[model samples]
Target: MDDKDLELLRILEENSRLSAQEIGSMTNLIPAEVEARIHALEESRIIRKYTTVINWEKAGNGEVSAIIELKVSPERDFGYDRIAERLSRFRQVRTLRLITGTYDLQLMVSGKNVQEVSRFVSEHVAPMDRIRETATHIVMKSYKENGNTLFEQQEAERLPYSF
Candidate 1:
């Protein structure tokens, strides 16, 4: 809300692991003040959750990820909210959003492999009452995510090929 609060949020966004004292030092606030502001942010839901963005490939737990666009027939009673909630309940669903676009809903899904993702769409998502169609786009590589670069400099570098 205030300048201090905004600055505090920026600091936390960079590194959530920073201690209250460290954050206070960077933001020019006392440790207690930093703690109070952070608590308020949490209560207000401005800071939903502190999370670590892991590079799954490097960790050797890489999962197949896809961005699926859905064109669904809205229910008469609750419209898209009801359907969105249903999709949210699935474990494969990572992110779901309703936007003003060609599709009614956009979903980011993860699975053990391509087959698993295809199966999820065919067996689970396609079976949903209102779902009319789905277009899946699998993520081949991610250069960056959540403002963090997935690949390091050395890994990105390659020798120039002379023709």
Candidate 2:
């Protein structure tokens, strides 16, 4: 990707709602050109889904969040992919990662309460054929969850000090 594409991505990452004209203004490109480049980016799957970052606490839905580490039976006889696919379908699962170390998979889960989360792990996750053991850590509060892309745009748009 060229510098223009990188700039476009930066803008879109901050706010996907920005119009092609608005993006064009920021990048000094014509609206049509901006539109075409955006189209190309989308078609190439470079720009995936546009999403909103909601503060669950402010929304009054924040109850609890947990990180679960799962140790699964080795995939020599059984396939881990199938298990991962099934785990991914759960509503409470925010993110799942297959990683190295003592654990095979790491899962980020959010629920209304501890009971709800425990039920999900015991009933849904534990019952799986390949799962050997699981460890869970409840999050009290997040110091930093995900970094804000908008901050970069704000910095870029900041005016220089006038002497």
Candidate 3:
């Protein structure tokens, strides 16, 4: 809402683990003020849940992720809101967006394996009445996610040259 609040949000967005005292130091506010502002932000729903991004490959989770594009016929009055709300209830859906593109909606979904994801698409998503078409793309690897790089880049080692 104010400049100090915006500054606090920026700092928290980068690292949510910082203490109110630490945030206060950066924002030039007292710890109590920092805490109160952050609480207000959370109550207003401007600051969503804090999350940690994990490199699941190294964790050995073997999670299968897919990006699904849906072409749909918008309902009369409600437009995409009705369908979007219904789709949001599905546990597999991680992210959903309505964008200016060929498809009306896009969804990010994940499951333990490809079969599970495929079954979700076929049984739950594709059969929906308003959904005209669906395209599912499986993710093979992730180099970066949520502003963090998943892999570390190393300098190439060169062979010794003869005189």
Candidate 4:
């Protein structure tokens, strides 16, 4: 991708609602060129699905979230790939990563409540053959996620001078 393509991607990442004409104005490309380039990017899978970041807590649909660290014994031939693939398929699993740390695999999972999440871990995750140990840390509150601050900083009110 060229510099113009990269610029388009950056603009889209910030706000995917921009029209081709609007993006063209920003990137100095004509609307038709902008549309063609965007199509190419989508076809090549460089531009994946556009997303909206929402604060679920404020929406009143808040769910319990947790980060679970797994100590896993890698499969003989496939290594961590097989286990990672399996974990990714679970509906509750939000994000999964292979990190350089004490844990072999780490996953972010969510559910309606603490009991539901705990039950999922005990019944499904911990009992898996390759999973040797697991550690779950529940997320109590989120100040920022995906680069968006959950709370806005309001200007403090001042009283009239008395002294």
- Which candidate leads the pack in lDDT? 3
lDDT of 4 by residue, 1-163 (tens): 9999999999998889999999999999999999999999999999978888888888888699999999999999899999999999999999999987899999999999999999999999999889999999999988898777898878998978986
Q: Which stretches of candidate 1 lie over 4 Å from their true place?
A: 154-163
- TM-scores of the models, in the given order? 0.88, 0.79, 0.92, 0.89
Global lDDT of model 1: 0.93
State which candidate, 1 or 3, has the greater lDDT: 3
Local distance difference test values of all predictions, in order: 0.93, 0.87, 0.95, 0.93
lDDT for position 23 in model 1: 91
**Residue 105 error for model 1, in Å?**
1.0
Residue 57 displacement in candidate 1 (angstroms): 1.0
User: How large is the C-alpha RMSD of every model relative to the true structure?
Assistant: 3.8, 5.9, 2.4, 2.3
Give the winner by TM-score: 2 or 3: 3
Q: Rate residue 123 of model 2 by lDDT.
A: 92
Give the Cα-based TM-score of candidate 2 against the true structure: 0.79
Candidate 2 root-mean-square deviation in Å: 5.9
Error of 2 at 128 (Å): 0.8
Residues 1-163 of candidate 2: C-alpha lDDT, one tens digit per residue: 7999999998888789999889989999999999999999999999988888766665678578999999998677555777888899999999999999999999999899999999999999988988999999998766554554322233456678898
Best-matching candidate per TM-score? 3
* Candidate numbers sorted by TM-score from highest down: 3, 4, 1, 2
